[model samples]
Target: MQERPPFKTLFAVPLHCEGCISSVTNALSQVEGILSVECHLEHQLVEVEGTAAPSKISKSLQDIGKDCILRGSGNANSAAVCILETHAPNVENPVRGLARLVQAGPEFTIFDISLKGLQPGIYQASIRQNGDISNGAASTGGVWEEDTRGTEARGRLGQIEVDSEGSGGIILDISVAIWELIGRSMVLSPGTELFRQDDEATLVGVIARSAGIWENDKVVCSCSGKTVWEERVEQTGKGML
Candidate 1:
């Protein structure tokens, strides 16, 4: 009889539709240490079962494009499982992530902007006000646009050049939350394009092989004899392939 650690921090959120849920699920599943996930569209609450810290969870959720807020936690009489492994892709230089911008559509345009001086790796790709929200993320790569939407409207926003003067900015390992477009940049809308790499933005990630493992876990209440099983998730290799 093994006692599992308690799960914590449930997140309740509001997504536009079932498509939104699918997008969120796909994004979060890429996280390395997540244990369980229950996304209920009826209540708009995504119950993520993991043993990681809340800050870590919050960052991960943001990376995947979730407007997540804490709700509650329960010590359910359930079986808990944990996994640990490494994986890589089959590409020369593989990024650690592969996100599809599930917002931008086929007609989203990436125009240059200039309120002043702009830098590479970081630029604001203006979003057309009259574009479809389903277009997905707007970036210079094909990864986000593929999983998020497709390769119909792949384009660049702006390039980024890292400053090496020492006072470097903080970097996030969003290699998991591949992106596309959403809300309008100059304007505001649901389908508006959301991601941008302005001059101030720094690119900090490595392309490598991705490898992961799948674990079959079940929760059985040692006291009540009730069981919670049939849970699974796919660990993907990012970057290389």
Candidate 2:
């Protein structure tokens, strides 16, 4: 197989709005080989991808009066990366829970996560993998993705599996938190390693266990924002309506 291209992610200063994205974009445009820049408004996270050097990226941003946090570094082909944010009111309660998600998939693939299921002050993160697992860490963002000081960690979850088959299956019932208001979802990183009968199962449906992706088929029901990762991926695979 062809080797995957190396990719690095970093967190820039807390941006207040799209204007901030424009600000960083305008400032960083002075650099070269910046393949793409995704500034998530919901997560308050800025992902810059390209041939640009991390140090240079840092220097330029710093010169422009912005700080950056490198989330992770790996080849995009091999590493699927996603971030979990839990910004509950009494956010402290969910800190440890969110950290667990980061530990679950250190070399996490950027899968679709939403926060609709999350309560105002409760937070958790879930990661799905199907091969050798890796450790991960948290930058300075909230567990459910918000502007605040948070923790970073690194470890491994068993692997990514959305469902199970014969012998291997989920070890425990996992919790999913979401917010209908913002169209965000958080897959709770397991408190311990989980097992599934199959490896190809999508994390959303399988991880939810016999009950399915949601307790009662409840999903982040929103028509405004983009369809979530699960819906989009499924629709694409099935050629949906």
Candidate 3:
């Protein structure tokens, strides 16, 4: 049998001196399944080559007082890209942006979102139950919906601030199980928004889906893709139409 290649992960650290470099390198080396640890002091980055669980490696570094940011990893592969769309198609001007989700660790995912051509202000972000980007549609429900407008905020993603140039960026650290969010969509409301009870008033839309769902190397939803509703039926044996 051919030997599998070792996993590699690059992390950004705060190494200021040789001692700090030595400490980080030694600590990572001690972790089980770690084949090698290389520190680049000039860049304050450490590269670990091994088969260790990413979460375990991060915890080991934290144990030694080394705070690290994951730059990239062999184990970190699942991700999705989304193009933000406006809810109202007839509106003369619309919000435009892109968002990406990447698996950061075993229990956490990172959401990197950027927006342009938006009104400069604060907006509320949340994950909704539908990946529908259409002007009007009904959702086949399989996920939790804590209604923020009427009852409570179920999947609150906090607020994002658009700057003077109508551009904004935010990185979200979500602790929810990533698999649960696979088929949902992200929605951004206009203004310093409160939980909106009306669906027609939403400003932006982007489907949150697995990176694997694509056609001809392009990600799209045109009634020809594997849908969240299908997954729900398979899991629960309940046909969703």
Query: What pairs collide in candidate 3?
Result: none
Cα lDDT tens digits, model 3, 56-135, are: 56668889998665556544245555556555546544446666665544646566677766778887777766666454
Error of 1 at 144 (Å): 49
Task: Give lDDT per model, in order.
Answer: 0.33, 0.35, 0.60
Model 1 compared with the native: what TM-score?
0.29
* Candidate of highest TM-score: 3
Better of 1 and 3 by TM-score: 3
For model 1, the superposed segments whose C-alpha errors exceed 4 Å read 1-6, 74-241
Model 1 over residues 189-236: C-alpha lDDT tens digits?
112233432212211122111111111122344665653221111112
Q: What lDDT would candidate 3 get against the real structure?
A: 0.60
Model 2 lDDT per residue over 34-84, tens place? 777777766556677654545455557778777554444333222222323
Cα RMSD of all models vs. native, in order, equals 18.3, 17.7, 14.3
User: How much RMSD separates candidate 1 from the native structure?
Assistant: 18.3
- TM per candidate: 0.29, 0.30, 0.49
Q: Candidate 2 deviates by what RMSD?
A: 17.7
